[model samples]
Target chain A: MTQPTARSGDRFLAAQPRGTGVQSANLADLLERVLDKGIVIAGDIRVNLLDIELLTIKIRLLIASVDRAREMGIDWWEHDPSLSSGKRGLALENRRLRERIGELEAGRTGRRTQSPDADYEDDETPPARPRRTRSTP
Target chain B: MTTPDLTWLYAVARDVEDGALDGLTGVADEPLRTLTVTGLALVVGSVPRSGFDERALQRRLADLQWLEAAVRAHHRVIAELARTGRTLPLRFATLYRDDRGAAAFLRGAGPRLRAALERVADRAEWGVKAYLAGAAPAPADIAAPADRPGTAYLLRRRAQRDALAQRFDEAMAAAREIHAALAALADRAAEHPLQSAEASGRAEPMLLNGAYLVDRERVADFGAAATELGRRFSGVRLELTGPWPPYSFADIGPEVPETVDPAGTGTAETAEADVEADVEAEAGFGADAGPDAATGAAPRIKPPEPRSPEQPAAAEGG
Candidate 1:
C-alpha cells in the first residue's frame, strides 16, 4: 500500500474511496449515506399507514445510535463555524466577548479609583477635587 | 399452511450436488432444497406452502422490513455461494411459497433460465466507486476591493466559484480515462453513473460510480489496474468492494418497478439501468432467465458492443 512517498495508512485509506468533497465525508454526507444507502430490503419499517415521519425517525434513531457520528455532529456545528454546523453562533459569541472587553477597557481609563491608564492619557482633563479632603470634615 | 412470515429463496449452481449444499439453509432456518428444472437447480427456499399467489406477494412487498429481511437472507446465502463458486443471482424479493413452487417455476422457465445462469458461470462481479475529489478550491469570501462597489465584488466572487468548479470537471476527465481502461477487461458492465448530488453535498466532487461483471480468473488484473490507478492518483480515492455475486451481472431485465432511491446516487441508477440494458444485448445469456429474472436486476437496453473499448472512451471524452 505504500507509495513512493510512503504516506501513512490513514492517508492511503482516506484516498481509497471515491474521492470527491471539500473535505472527507462531513456529517451530512455520512448521515445521509450510512442511514439510507447499501443493500436494503423492503421491510415494514419502510411501510406505515402514514407519511415521511418514518424517514425523520429513522434519522433520529440512526443519529442517536451512532455515538461518534453524533459527537462529530456536535463538533461540526461548533467547530466548523458554518451556517448549518452552528459556526455562526460561535462567531457571534466571539464578537460579543470582544465588545465586552472594549467596554471594560474604556471604564478603566477614567475611574474615580486608581486609574490604570492615567499615565498613557496624554490629554489632560480637569480633576474634580481630592477624595481625602471630603472625608476629613 | 402458514410459515408466519415471508421466507427467502436462494440461487445456487446447477452443478452443486445436492449433498454439497446439504447443510445450507434458506430464509426460515429450514433445510435448503434446490428448485430443479430440466436437471438444473433453479432455486432453493425456506417457504412453507407448496405454492403462493403472486398478486398477494406484490402487495406484501410494500413492507420494507419484510423486504429487508428477505434481501438480507438472500444476501447471506449469495455471499456464501460466492465463497464456493459462480451463481447467477435472482432479483431481490423473489419468493416461492415453498420448494415445490420454486421447482415448478424452474421447470416452466425451461431453456431460457438455464442459458442465463450458465452465461454467468465461472464469473463474478466487482464494484468500483470513483468520486471526483475537490475539483474546487475552498470557498472564498474575498474582502471588498477598494476599487469597486456596485457589481464588481459580486462578479469577482462568482468568478472565483466558477474557477473552482472546473477543477472537478478536469478530475472527471481523468477518471473516465481510468474507467475506460478497466471496462476492457470485463465481459459486460452496468451504466456509468452520472448524478452527483452526494458528491455535491460532499466537500469533493464525484466523477464516476460504476460496477463491472468480469470472469473470476481476471480479478487480479482488475485489482492491479485499480491499484495502478490508486498509485497514479494517489491524490484520489478509488473505493473498491466485492467479488460478490453477479448482483450486477444477474440480468432478467426491468419488468419489476424500482422507485427512485437516490442514496447510491449515480452508481445505483446506472446499476439499475444496466440490469435492463444487458438483457437487451443477448438472450439465453446461459438459458434460464429465472421467473423474476426479467425483473429489475438486469439491463433493459443493450447497445452493440463497441468495436473496441477505446472508441467509447474516445466518444465520451470527445
Candidate 2:
C-alpha cells in the first residue's frame, strides 16, 4: 500500500470540483455509486472457443441516482428485503392473516351459538334408544 | 495468437473540453484519452486483453493487492474527469475490445447518458453515515438475588436484552432524524441499506448510510447541516463525507435501453461457473463491490468551526 499522502484525509475535499469547499471521494463514496446508481451498460465481450463461450465478459454497468433510477424504472431494491426495509409487504401480510383468523373464529363461534338444538338433539338421540343385540337372549 | 489490446472505459462526459483530460492517466498508468461518440466523450485507456480477460480478471479481483491498484487507478480517472464536467463514471474495469465498440456503445445510449449527466449537472453527492459507537451501557449489573438464583438469572438476562433493544431503537431514531435534517439541506436524498459490521470494519453498528444530491452552491450549507446534526447527535458517531461524483444519483434513467446486452453478468464470477451468485463485493470497509475493501482509519472529523454562516464561505479553498 502507498504511504499516506500528507493530506490524505481531505484529499477528496482538496479535489473538490471548485474552491467552494466541496470534498473529494473515498473508496466508500465511490462504491456507493458503483454498486447502486449509475448507468449499467451491458457490453458484449465474449471470448469463444469451438462455439462455446470460454470467456464471457459482460460489463453490467449501472451508475445513476435514486430519481434517475426511478425514472429509468429500475428499482429492484424496493422489493428486496436485504436491500430495503420491506415493512409494507410484511405489514400487509400480517393484517391479512389477522383478518382471516378473525373471520374464521367468528364463523366457528357463530355456528356453535346458532345450533344449540343440534347439540341437544345429538345428546338426547344417543341415549333415547336401547341397543338390541343381533342374538336376542 | 497475440492478445488483443482492450480499451478500458473509465467515464463518459458530455461537452468536456478535449484539453481538460491532458496528462490524466488511467488503469495500468496509460495516458487517458477521449473517444468522441455522437455527443458523448468517453474517458478511456488502453490495456492488454490478457490483463482484463473475464477469467483472469475474476482471479485478479480476489487478489487484494492487484485489485486495490486497479480500483484506485480507475477511480482516480473518474474523479479527475468529474471535475472537468458532468461525467458518467463507468463500472470499474469496463473493458471493450477497442474504441469502435466503446463508441458504438456510447452512441447507442446517447440520449439516456445525456439525461443522466443533466440530472447531475450543478449537483454533487454527499454521504452521511451514523454509527453506534458502542453498546448502550447496561441498565444495571446487579447480581442475581441469592434466594432465587435460577429465576433471577433469567430475569437479569431478559433485562439486558431489553435494554440493548431499546438502545438500538433509540439509535435508529436518532439516525432517522439526522438523515431527515441532512436531506432537507440537499436537493435529493437516498438511504442506503445498512452495511454489516464485518463489511464496515467498524465494531460500532452502522445506523444509517445515506447519500444526498446537493446543488453545488449549497455544498457549504449541506456541510453545516451535517455539522449541526453531528453536534445534535453526539452519542452517535456521525460521518459526513463527500461532494462526490454524484455516485448515488447518476443512473441512466428508468427506461432500459435496447442497446444494452440483455445478458449482463454480474461481477461475482465463481471459481467454477456455478459459484454462488453473490454480487456483494467483499465484506470490508472502503470501496464498493468488496474485494479491495481498505482497512484505513475512518476519515477524521475536525472540531466544529464557529457557527457563523460566513465561516463556510471563508473556509473555501483553505
Q: Per-residue CA lDDT of candidate 2, range B1-318, in tens?
A: 223778888888986686776776777778877887655688888887777776666555544334445665776677777776788788765677777777766655566676667767888777777776443455477577779977776666566666666666677778778877877887667766555432332335677778787888877666666666665665576655665776665655433443443476532211223322222222121223322222112322221222222234765443
Kindly list the per-residue Cα lDDT of model 1 for residues B133-189, writing each as its tens digit.
422355455566667864655655565546544554455556666667777887765
Q: What TM-score would candidate 2 get against the native? A: 0.58
Q: What is the lDDT of residue A79 in candidate 1?
A: 23
Question: Cα deviation in Å at residue A57, candidate 1?
Answer: 11
The docking quality of candidate 2, as DockQ, is: 0.09
Candidate 1 ranges beyond 4 A from true positions? A1-64, A67-137, B1-8, B17-24, B48-66, B138-146, B149-155, B192-205, B231-236, B252-318
Interface RMSD of each: 17.8, 18.8
Number of colliding residue pairs in model 2: 29
Docking quality class, candidate 2: incorrect
- Model 2 residue B225 CA deviation in Å: 1.8
In terms of lDDT, which candidate is strongest?
2
